[model samples]
Target chain A: MLESYIEQLQRVETLGELNDQVVALRDTLDVEHVVYHSVNSTGEQYAALTYSPEWVQRYLDEDYTRIDPVVQACYRRFHPIDWKRLDWTNKNVRNFHGEAIDSGIGNQGFSVPIRGPSGQFALFTVSGNASDDKWASYTQEHVRDLLLVSHFVNQKALELERGTDQVQTVSLSPRETDALTMLAMSYNRAQAADSLSISEHTLRVYIESARFKLTAMNTTHAVARALSQGLLII
Target chain B: MLRYIYADDLHRFPRLARSMFVDRAKQFHDRLRWDVTLRDDGTERDDYDDANPLYVIWEDTTGGHGGSMRFLPTTGDTMVNDHFLHLTDGVEIKSPFIWECTRFCLAPGAPAQVSAALMLGGMELGLNNHLSHSVGVFDARMVRIYARLGWGPTILGTAGQGRDATSVGLWAFEPELRPRLLSRAGITDEMSRHWYDRSFGALTPTAKPALSA
Candidate 1:
């Protein structure tokens, strides 16, 4: 069963074993491809995929990463996105799309954008060549499984690369915590500032400082981390 | 009658869910030419559909698909966070009380009243679950419809060039529109009460007043 694959992934000791699990996951989900690519905080990279070797080579030869809308779009997101919703405008992107489709890469794709400790960003993608209707049902049917599998993969990879004891607890200043709490409670900058009796500019400073301390991508991310870590209470 | 279908329960309603896909194919692919994939069986589905989304489905008396809307926790993967953040001026709306709604579909030949009912049911589902905001990417036409129904949502992004310009935004659960929209759609009080009464038969029914006006 697919659940067993996740259990195997947890005990995987080497990259090879981890990759085999990913392929097994792809098969279990009945999708054409499954890919996980990560760029760690230190800019070190690792990728596992089911793409053809020639396509991978061509992608590298043309440096498609620079023009990949999926990558660009996912970098700014904290959610999983459907490929159809992505903007594929411009001649180069269209050509790349055509090439990818021709290379037997599935016509339908979905990617989940993940963020981990120390500003790490990673993506887990599932793709297939089903009709829009079938793919919709397929994605709807397996999204939960995919999300669970993805986080498991990312956690295992992180453990392998940087052992498990590296957890760092982030602490924010009193003012920073106050600012984050207000933001988490759905207060706008001006409203939060007014409640704190600080100028908007001062509130901005507090938020920025908290963001730095937490290494969050944005204020929302900062608020999320603070709430999750019990650094800020509602 | 509207029913809630969580991811775990979806498998038990395969026929019902597949009907929604078929209806979506007709609406998005054949009618709107939205470049979506259509299965040989004439159903339409996408990757986001797999993410254990909460589904609010309005079914006809004959058990056919009527209208449906999908909900995802904003803390997880959502269309607004992934592709439409520009609508929020680059701000991410991440809150446990916020959910993203997408893939709203109404089967062709459904009555006009189905639209208002779908909106009311979707928002009521959010309110009942303690969700504050329901956000998603929507075309400009929906802006007019929402405004007319007194459910004016905040526009997060500006509409861009082209005939099919789309934007993202959120609809808060306040201003309770169930009664107002139902009346506007010419639905009688008896019909309205029937929906609420039937919903109780579904899983985890909330208080009727929360879904009522």
Candidate 2:
């Protein structure tokens, strides 16, 4: 599962592709469903999935998305979550869960939250019939991979939607510029620091310098400013 | 350090790519080339310069960096090139797979290293896959740069656009000569980490290895 899934998810470059992977995983595990849900910096919702026809139809026909507990809870939280952990005490939620399960969505599920700048938020989730123990193991082993996949998928989607135009709002140094560029291209700070052959502390210094120059409030804003100004190209 | 887009660098990459592309656009405009910029959302682009590879030049031999360009592959996938490059009359020309270089500019008092990096990277991307050849119009002052990099002449319809005689010079040729310097230097399909303090992420799977004393 790990090896094959890793290979398939490696080249994923859009939110659409990431959703495809989730759907694939659900089928591979012979689970009830799989879903990758994302909200961009603009709060636009994008999703790819393999839900039962009944639930999908119901969602569209009745607009259950507006009141779905999964959607509401996932948005409020900041971590990978389980469906069971959400506020399912509501009668409507219980009824929806019953309907979803009846339609073969299974009772056990897991979700991981993703964060980005400009209010970009996303959730990757899988659901299936399984013992609590089994679900726990599955998530622990694959959490890191899922987190990475979600971001790459989201990145491509953003690119497709954002296109390739930039504004100049900041001035960064070559090294600082390089560090931020690597990070912008999706390398975590640690990976970027390693690529630059400098200590993480040094990387932090460069990032701070860039952030100040851009007048950005945080690391993400600095990246945004640098990108807008054409100081770096991914 | 240098980096290439791959699968590992996904986490936090979308924002990174968006930033980098934006910065690249500004660099182009700053250099007196074409003014190509990204939209505010920072996701999609559709300007005159979209048909290019978005290159940054760095000269390691002299510790300098400046200039940027977008390299659009004519060889790898004509569809991709046309998607960005407005081939209005349609790309119905005889030449099918040709790369288009666009939105190029350099900073004032730029370093030789920046040009070197751009040249190497552009050539590498050209040779990395199938490309009929490369094409672009340049200011007369930069004509020497293109010639030094080995791009010139050929069989094609004349494209004398705009009154600037230099801008009217349209040319195309195969990348058969010397774009493979990168693969030769042992930088193949492995993941790369391009260091830019700008805000952006990775294209491939980027794993930061633990440094041991």
Candidate 3:
């Protein structure tokens, strides 16, 4: 079911369409609410959530982000967090939680943080009213699926923000890829040359040319770049 | 091969450990340009290394560091709790089932599989110790690498931007994923198991007791 949603997400071209898909996802997953909120590096904020407009406006007017433990905790963490694990001990936080509950935001929440290129930060969250044990089990069973969704949503968001549909790719020749792959596998020049049925000098030429194509400083840098760019699988 | 060496045990592999630290200095301080302290000995050492953290290192054929990562239980003072709390919105992650992995470094000419091997070693540590997750703070470039390895972490939050963007992520331990990681590292199951058992076999419940009755 989530896989289908990820497929739909990939085709969504506009933020409005993404919001509709998120709403549909909330219903499909039987969650009370789903929220995708992003704050780009330049501090531009966008949100597609199930919360009421009045509540959303109130949150911004009152600057609840300053007090919301979920936002605060999620902002700092690199792992999915259960609302129960967050610190709500402070008076301000307690009041914020109470207000959120009163606004039909539910008593339980789980959030996944997303970090995209250019310092884009986003949170994909699900909240609902449930028993502690029920919520725990729910999150446990669905964490992986939700994580995949969070990242995909963020990727789409970044793509839309950048207004570019084409993914940038660098093409390396077959021999170049083999040379870098060999180097990445920790094969020395002689060994790589032997395995590739080429002379050591020829292998060096391939590596140096590959390095130039990758704009790398050396063999190590070229291998690192190739791997990071998903150019060489190994 | 993966060698799990604690700080106290580092003396047993003096040259390998020294090379590991030197490579760390080169990667973090020189190449990445992270704000790290480099010692007069041309090595990078930090407060966490003094905490007796376990180091998972891949040794090359020459018996030097190929790639390495540092692990310390989150229950103790760790890099995330002590220095990176702001990234976590001030919440300190302290769990017996979760450890903090940091300072992942590779030698200048190390092969790419070294990274995957180091990750495999991390998974082995989690499985052997019954840990559920490992957390780390990494940069944008590492995100791509992790994704490529099919072991991307669930990011908790991020700071900075562009080339400097840093994020904290938690990696869950799924025993079923071991085979895929093994293949990625180009390591056979037998060798992986041997390395793991060599490091932790005695601690297992099935292992024979040192002082037999």
Q: Best candidate, DockQ-wise?
A: 3
Q: What DockQ does model 3 achieve?
A: 0.03
Model 1 C-alpha lDDT per residue in residues A135-215, reported as the tens digit of each score: 777877766566656766876787778754556466666777888889998999999989988666546645754664554
**How accurate locally is residue B116 in candidate 2, as Cα lDDT from 0 to 100?**
45
Q: What is the lDDT for A139 in model 3? A: 81
**TM-score of candidate 3 chain B vs. the reference:** 0.92
The regions of model 2 sitting more than 4 angstroms off are A1-22, A27-31, A164-234, B1-213
Interface RMSD of 2: 22.0
**Root mean square deviation (Cα) for candidate 1:** 17.4
Candidate 2 has a TM-score of 0.37
The alpha-carbon deviation from the true structure for residue B67 of candidate 2, after best TM-score superposition, in angstroms, is 49
What is candidate 2's lDDT per residue for A1-234, written digit by digit as tens? 534554465446555666677677765555577777777756677878888667789878977767776776556333345565556556676666667767777767766555443446667777777766776677666555554444444444555466434422334457777888988998998999889886564466456545544444457866876787778888
> Which lDDT values do the candidates have, in the order given?
0.70, 0.51, 0.76
Task: Output the worst ten-in-a-row residue range by lDDT, candidate 3 chain B.
Answer: B203-212
Model 3 earns a TM-score of 0.47
What 10-residue stretch in candidate 3 chain A is worst by lDDT?
A: A208-217
Winner by TM-score = 1
